[model samples]
Target: MEKGKVVVLEDRVPKLKERRRQKANRRLIAYLSFFFLFILCVLYFQSPLGAVGHVEVSGNRHLTAERIISLSGITKRTSFWKVNEQNVEEKLTRHPEIKEATVEKQLPNTIAIHVREWRRIAYVYDRQTFFPLLENGRLLKQEGTKTAPSDAPVLVGWKDGDAIAEMTGQLAELPAAVLGAMSEIHYKPTREYEDRVIVYMNDGYEVSATIRQFADKLSHYPAIVAALDRNVKGVIHLEVGSYFVPYSPPKKEDGDETTSP
Candidate 1:
């Protein structure tokens, strides 16, 4: 019985040693894996691989790509992990010409910026220069040019601030074709018609209209002009009702119908 007990104790010693060996192997593998991951993370952040390599800009017109990128405050040296998309977008939108802006990050090394710029619809003459007016009724002094814009109508005599605002709003609602047909708009308010305006058309006809129903009535201008005799030059009254009054030719003096050459 003493010999058998000694044999059993001897067998248990090897089994315990094997178990210890297996545990140490697992620990070694765990340590190696952790170190490998740490090294990779350090390399990724410290190397040029994590730097912004490319910047793409889209949907920009009045503002150039370089200008948009400059406004965004992002550079090629910026780290991919450190880019703040919301902050960049806010900075880009601060430009008066940019209506909307979006910034996005592409994995590994690229930044993309998209922007929408304001549309220049017309120009208002001020201090002998024409300043660009946006579709939203905002005027941009920087967009001013020394010469009048050929494609847009020139606003004249609408000096009152409120009247100018109202006129701009009305102009915004008119179709591009209708607006293009007009050469100039002059404010000619009367006691009976306080909102009256005189519009000189590119087609050589004059229009009398009130601001209250300016856009609504001017939409019918093409039809009204088409119904009239094209050879006759006249004033189209769109205030009380739409009608045409032909300009009277010069009359002969002292019953003489013949003219001197």
Candidate 2:
């Protein structure tokens, strides 16, 4: 032994302990790596990480969820990460009955779809069955045997493209008071007067006007009715402007109030 050099009695013991520590670390790393690989396999094949399980639908009115989902062609096999949300929405919205559709992906395995359905503003009579006219003025194909719907008015006019849109615009602009008072809308589209429209009000008064000015003209109806006698039953011509033609009344003596035209 050299002078000033100290030797520890447990040299071999220290080396043995260091080798044990290294082995423990290697085992721990191996265990952690195995766990990581196992998790990756589970996620890749058996886990719900990419599977679709829940389908939530919202904002639908006319069309049911099942119908919309079927139309969209989205299935449980659809992978959430690989789904084309816009394509799904486009498929659902292609139908005239569907106004709008939105698709969203939830975590794990869930999907949500929100849809806005068209509103039926009127009905187009097809001899036996009447197809509903949506608020956008698009007419749907007749689906059933239900006769006149007592709820909304029946549209009688040239049944074709953009007709429903025109009618819907007019209906949307109608005053709540007049709309509540209206019974029917007679659509008489003609070359002589392209925008002609006639409506039968619940108060037994007739409204004849062009749709071009229908909204503005109909707004003055309550005042027009208020200024006239309740017994007056005739056509209120809002076609050119506000004018009332009374039904022929019995000629009265000079003392009676002079009736309006």
Top model number, TM-score: 1
Name the lDDT of candidate 1.
Answer: 0.85
In TM-score terms, candidate 2 sits at 0.64
lDDT of 2 by residue, 106-136 (tens): 8766789999887666677666676777777
The estimated TM-scores of all candidates read 0.69, 0.64
Worst 10 residues of 2 by lDDT: 142-151
RMSD of each: 6.8, 5.9
Off by over 4 Å in 1: 1-34, 150-152, 176-183, 190-192, 200-206, 221-236, 244-261
Pairs in clash, predicted candidate 1: none
